[model samples]
Target: MKKYLVQFKPFLIFIGTFFATYILLTLIYKSYLNHFESDDVDEITRIVGYNVDLLLHAFNSDVFIQKSVSNPWLEVWYNNDYVIRIVEGCNAVSVIILFISFVIAFSRKFKTTFLFILSGTLFIYILNIVRIALLAILLFRYPEKVHLFHGVLFPLMIYGVVFALWVFWVNKFSKYAK
Candidate 1:
């Protein structure tokens, strides 16, 4: 048992650190969210919706997002048609949290880790907004394939990027690399 434990020490440490960071950040985010009324969207989600609206407009699409009166989501309207709801999950904070957790688990130098986390988080956030905007436009054009685009393709894209970032970190910057 001791031999096995010694052999797996690094892996165990990586797993422990990853979960600790993920849980801590998720709890903090949930607590922040708890401050909002049930009928009101959290600030992060609202900002995501707003950014999606801005991106859509940049593409010359008739787009606007408004808080839904009946639910804690933003209604995204494209070309005067109700297209999709920008819910909290659509905000991608959870994905960012996961990304940060993995990066921290394999962390190296403080400056490098900090810069990577900051840049990675920003990149994920921007990509999420672009994903939402593109999704809204695509949904408007191909309402028939909502499941494929939203459920599979977009998720694959975001998670794929995060996975790539994790791989890059491990090979290029992590302590494990040394």
Candidate 2:
């Protein structure tokens, strides 16, 4: 029993740390969301939707126009014909939290881990905004392939980025790296 415990200690620690960090951050986010007015939607999600709407509007003023985002929900209309609704899961905070948890599990030096988490989180956030904007544009252009694009491709793209970041960190900065 003692030998088995010793052999699995590292794996156990990693799992523990990952869950602890993930849970703590999730709770904090929930607390933050509690301050928002909407019962169905959170403020961070609304901000993400707002930013996506703003970016799409800026890119093509005449084509991709924002219909309404004053409330918690975001609705962006394309060519005054089709509308794309930005929802909570599209916000990408969950992905960031997952990324952070993994990074923490394989942490390096304190300063390095902190900075990497910050930069990585920012990168993911920006990517998510662009992703939402591009997805809206794609849906506008190819309305027929909505499920293929939204349900399959976009999720793969976002998760792929997260995986790439984790790979890079493990190889370049993690203490356990060979």
Candidate 3:
């Protein structure tokens, strides 16, 4: 038993750290969300929606986002069409938390880990905004393919970037790389 425990110590530590960080960050985010009234969209989601609106407008696309009166989401209108809802899950905080947790679990030096987390979080946030904007445009053009665009392709794109980031971290930056 002791021999097996010693052999698996590193793996156990990685899993423990990953889950602990994930849970802590998720709880903090949830608490922040709880501060908002049920009918009101949380600040992060609103910010994402605002950014999406800005990005679309920058491209000379007709777009606007407004808080939904009846629900906790923002309605994204693109090209004078109702395209999608920007919800809390669309804010990408959850993805950032997951990225941070994995990075921490494989972390070595404090500065490197902190920098990676900061940069990675920013990258994910920006990518998500772009994703939302692109998704809005695509959905407006291909309303019949909502499932393919929203449910599959967009998710694949976000998660694919995350997976690529993880691979880069493990190969180039993580303690395991050494």
Candidate 4:
């Protein structure tokens, strides 16, 4: 009924905007993955990740970057010492998704959502820095385990954290959920 619709307009708007953004973005993301080579962004991520990796290794660990190749062609990096370093694309996506999901889960109003998104974004950036650092150490210490370390484990870990945060937000923080 019109009355019910009017009462839920704000809620509807939030849901609509959130879902619309997500769905549209997902489609675009898929299209890009299918049609375009995103090696540029991937290379940028690798550069960032590698820098973080070196910094973490400097904290009294045996990790060393003997040589790194910035392959602009396929976004691949090879440590002359250790072959086939993990790509940074997936890590970057995970970081971005984590913050977006956090904002959706935690925020109620526009202002709060913006602030919370910013805060969550900051956390995402920091977590990425940490992720890169950890990845570097693991890459050095367990070079053969790169697939499990980069492809499976860290992403699962980050997503698990985001899922927990989402559960907390909906149960403990979201006013609309109540």
Off by over 4 Å in 4: 1-15, 23-47, 50-54, 57-70, 73-80, 83-91
Ten-residue segment with the worst summed lDDT in candidate 1?
50-59
lDDT of each: 0.95, 0.83, 0.92, 0.59
Candidate 1 stretches with Cα past 4 Å from truth are none
Per-residue lDDT of candidate 4, residues 26-144 (tens digit): 67665655553544334445555566656655685544432234443222233434433445453465456545754564467777666656665666666766776677667766888
Question: What is the model-wide C-alpha lDDT for candidate 3?
Answer: 0.92
Comparing 1 and 2 on TM-score, the stronger one: 1
Kindly report which residue pairs in candidate 3 clash with one another.
Answer: none
Best by lDDT: 1
| lDDT of candidate 3 over 114-167, digit per residue (tens) | 998999999999999999998898889889999998999999999999999999
Q: Give each model's clash number.
A: 0, 0, 0, 0
Clashing pairs in 1: none
Number of colliding residue pairs in model 2 = 0
| TM-score for each of the candidates | 0.98, 0.89, 0.98, 0.62
| lDDT of candidate model 1 versus the reference | 0.95
Q: Quote the lDDT for 69 in model 1.
A: 87
Weakest ten-residue segment in model 3 by summed lDDT: 49-58
Output the better candidate (2/3) by TM-score.
3
Tens digit of lDDT per residue, candidate 1, span 2-30? 99999999999999999999999999999
